[model samples]
Target chain A: MAHSEDVDHTSHGQSMGLLRVLGPAHVWALGVGIVLVGEYMGWNFAVGKGGAYAALIACWFAGVLYSCVAMIDSEVTSTVAAAGGQYTQAKHIIGPLMAFNVGLYLVFAYTMLEAGNAITLGFLVDTVAGMTGHEGGLDQRPFIVLAIMFLAWLNYRGVLATLTFNLVITAIAFSAIIVMFLATSPLLGAGEMLHKDLMSGQASLPYGWLGILAAMHFGLWYYLGIEGTTQAAEEVRSPARSLPFGTLAGIMTLLIAATLTWYVCSGLLPWEYLGDGVNGAVAPLFSAAQISGSNALVWLLGIGTLFATLASANGCINDASRAWFSMGRDHYLPAWFGAVHPVYRTPYRAIIFLVPIALIFALGAPLDQVITFSILSGLLGYTFMPINMIMFRKKWPLDTIKRGYEHPLHPLPAISLMALCSVTYFAVFLGYGTQLIAMIGFYIVVSLWFHFWRYRFVKRADQFTMPWPRPRGY
Target chain B: MMDTWNYIEYGAWALSALFGLLIVIDWIKIDTTYSEEALTSSREGELEAMTEKHRLEG
Candidate 1:
C-alpha cells in the first residue's frame, strides 16, 4: 500500500544548524558524553566491588553490540531519511498505527531516560557535598527539575547550540577523567588491575558467561542516545555523507575513552575499599577519589559526572523534541507540536510538552527501572529497524546504498549483530524480572491504545495532513 | 592554544545562544525563489509540446 505521497522538506531551516559551533572532534566528544558517561555511572552504582573488572568487560562487549545497532539505524535513516527518525522510518515499513504506537513508546522511554540522567546529576551533587562533610543537606528532586529546564532551554536554541554544549561539557568531563588517570598511573600494577576472586562471588559473575551479557544491560544503557545524532541528520550538514561518518567516529572515540578510564580505575582502587556495601552504586568513583586523596579530584569528578549525565538528557530532549516536531508536521501528532519558534527556528511547542512529562518521571519514577526500560526499548527498536534496512535492500535495490560503509562483512556482520542483541535482550530479562515486566507492559499498553486511536479513529488519507498552511517558500 | 582562557564551562552557555542566532540568520537570509534553470527547462518543454500540438491540430 502507498504511504503519504508528498515529502515536504518543511524543517526549521534547510541549512543545517550544526555549522554554528561544532567541528568533528567536538561532535565526537559530545558522542562520548551521550554514549558512555551514563553507562559508567550505572556500572559504578550497580556492580559495586566488581565494577572495574567485570562491569568494564561487559560494557565493552555491549559497545560492540551498540555499534551494530547504530549501523542498522544508519541504513534505515539513509533510505527513508525522514526528520521523524525511527518513528517515520517505522511508519514507512509497517503502518501508520504501528508507527504511532512506536513513537509514543519512544517518547515515554526517552522521557524516562531524561529523568534518570537528571536524577543521576542530583545524586552526584549530593554525593560530593556529603563527602566534603558539608553541613547543609542536598535533595535530588529540585535539582532534577532545574536540570530538565536548563537542558530544554539549551536545546530550544538549535542543533549547533546543543552540540556545542555537549562538546564543551564533554571536554571538561573528559579532562577530569584524564587527570584522574594521569594522577593514578604510577600506582597501577598487574595484580591490582587483574584481581578477580571467583570464590568470593564479588567480581566474578555467578552465571558464568551469560551473566556478563546480562550485566551489559547497565553499560549499554548509557550509550542509548547516540542514534539521536543521526535522527538530526536533516539538520546536520550533508546527511548522506557526514552523518554516517560522524556516527561511527563518535561511537569509536567514546568506547576507547570510557574503556581506558574503567581499566585504569579498576587497577588503582582495591576491591574492598572500592565498595562500601553490597550493590553500592557510588563506590567505583569514590574509590578513585579516595586513591587520589585530593579533594580537588573528588569535586571535579563529581561535578564532571553531573555535567556529563545532564548532557545525555540534554541530547535526548533535543533529539526527541525534533522527532515530535516532525510528527506534528506530518499530522501524526497534533498541530501544536509542529509550531517552530519564529525567532529561533526551533520546535518550541514540542519542548514545552516534553518538560512536564520528563519532570513527572524524575519526581515519581525509579531511576533503575527507567534505565532498564530504556535499554530494553532500544533493543526492541533496533530489532524492528534492521528489518526495514533489509527490506530496502531487496525492494529498492540500490547497489551503492546497500553495500556502502557497513562492517565489511555485509549482511553476515549485521546478522551477527542482531543475534548478539537478541541474546543480550533475553539475558537481561531473565536477570531482572521487574524491568522486563515494566518494558513489556509499557509497550503492549501503548501499542494497543494506538491501534484504536490511529487506525480505527483517523482515516489513512488524513495521516499526512499539514498542521500549518503550506508556506510559499521552500 | 597555551595560556588561553578555558571556555569549557562558559562555552556551554554561550554556544547555545549563538546557535539560536545562526538559525535565525539562516531563515532570514536563505533565497526561497525557484532557480532560473528550473524555470527555463519547464518553458522549453512547454514550448516544444505546444508546437507539436499545433502541428497535430493543423
Candidate 2:
C-alpha cells in the first residue's frame, strides 16, 4: 500500500507538466501573445476621436498597472512554483477554496473572452463580406461556435499546434496594422482633422476625476493578459529567469508598437471624418481605407482583425486550460483536469472541459455583454494578483526566491495597481451595471461558501498561517 | 497603380529584411549570459532543497 505522502507527491508530479510544455521560447511566445491581446483590446476600440488622447492617457495608466502586475506575478510564480498557477498562489496564502473561486472567475473570464473576440471577428467578417457584395450575411452565433471549435481543436491537438497557429496569424495581424499606417497616412490632407462630436462636452465635466478614473475599466480590460507567460511555468526552461525577462520584453515591445500604431492611425484621418457617434470597433481602420480609396487596405484590415480575434481565442484557451490543470494538480479540482495526455503530454482533460463550456458560452450568450464582462472579471482577477503577492511576502519571507527584477518603488506599484483596478471596477459597474452586479455577486457568494467548505480541507492538509511578517533585509 | 503597389510592397520587404539582419548581428555581438550562471545554479539548489522539505512534510 502506498503512503499518503506518496500519493500527494505523485499528484504534484503530474501537475508539474507545465514545465514540460512551455519551455523558454514558448513562454516568450505566450508573453508576446498576451501583449497582442492587450493591443487588440485597446487599439480596436478607439481611433480618430477627441477622447483618443483621454483614452491614450487611460491606456498609459493601464500600462502602469501592467508593470506592477508583472512584478507581482513574477514574485508569486517564483515563490509558489506550483501548477495551480494563479489560483494555487492564492490558495497557498488565503485558503484552498479562495484559490478555487479565483480559478472559477478566471475560467469564466477567459471563456467569455473567447466569445468577445469571436463577436469582434463576426463584425469584421460581416463588414468585409458586405464590402465585397456577399449577401445573406454570416450568422454570428454559428461563426462564433465555429471559431471556438477551431481553437479547441488546435489546443486539443497540442501546444505546438496552438502556438504555431497563433504565431503565424499574429505576425500577419501586426503587419496589417503597419500597412494600415502607411496606407492611411496620406488621407490627412483630405479633410478637417477635428470634428465637433469628438468632444464629450463641457457638461460631462461634472463626472470629474471619478468619471475619468472610471475610464480605467476600458484601459484595464486592454491590459489583462500581461502575466500570461507564468501559466506555462513548468513547460518553460528556467522559468525563474525567463518569466520576468519574457514578460517585460513582450510588454515593452507592445508599448512601442501600440504607441506607433495608434499615433499613425489616429493621425492619418481627422477626428471628425471618422464616425464619432458610432461605437465602431474596427471603424478607424475602415475610415482610413475609405479615405485612401484602397479596397485592398480595407481587406487587409478586415483579415487582420479576424486573425487578431482568433489569436485572442487561441491564447485564452491555452492559458485557461493550464489554470485548470494547475488547480487539479493542487487537489482543489478533480484529478482528471490535471491529467496529461500520455502521448501529447498536454493537459488534455482541462482542454476538453474548457472547450465545451466555452462553446456553450459562445453559442448561448450575448456577445457584447460577454466581451465587457470578461474585461471586468479579468481586471478584478489582476487586482487580486498583487494583493496575493503582498500577502506572500508578509507571511513567507522567501528571500532566496526573489527574481532578477523588483518594483522600483515597492508598495507604490502595488498601491497604483490597486487604485487603477478600483477605478476600472467602479467604472465597469457604472458603464455595465447589470453584468458587474451579476459577476461581483457571483464572486462574493462563491468566495464565502468556498471558504467554509475549504476550511475542512485545510484542517486535513495545510495549517492556516496568519498574517505574514515583514522582512528586514531587502 | 500596379507599379506603385509593387514598389511599396518591395520597399516594406527590404526594410523588414534589413531589420532581421540587424537583430541577428546584435544577438551575435551581445553576451547575454552573465557569470551569474553560477549564482543561479546555487540558488536553484537551495530552492530544490526547500521544495523537497515541503514535499516530504505534506
Say which candidate scores most in DockQ: 1
Q: Name the weakest run of 10 consecutive residues (lDDT summed) in model 1 chain A.
A: A1-10
lDDT of each: 0.58, 0.60
Steric clash count of candidate 2: 13
Using lDDT, give the best candidate's number. Answer: 2
Provide DockQ values for all models, in the order shown. 0.03, 0.02
TM-score of 2: 0.76
Give a tens-digit lDDT track for model 2, residues A158-199: 787677677778777777777666554446433432323344
Steric clash pairs (candidate 1):
A45-A281
TM-scores for every predicted model: 0.75, 0.76
Candidate 1 local lDDT, A1-474, one digit each (tens): 111110112222132112223345444544566665653465543244234455666667767766876676666664443456777666655667657755765666567778888877776656665655654556455566667867887776666777777878877776777666666565542233434442245454434565455556556654666766545644544454555666777777667666766665656654444433234435355456556677787777776776678777877787678677666655566654555553355666677678888878888877777766666766676666556566545544454343324444457646766777777677676667677787778778866766656445433554432121222221
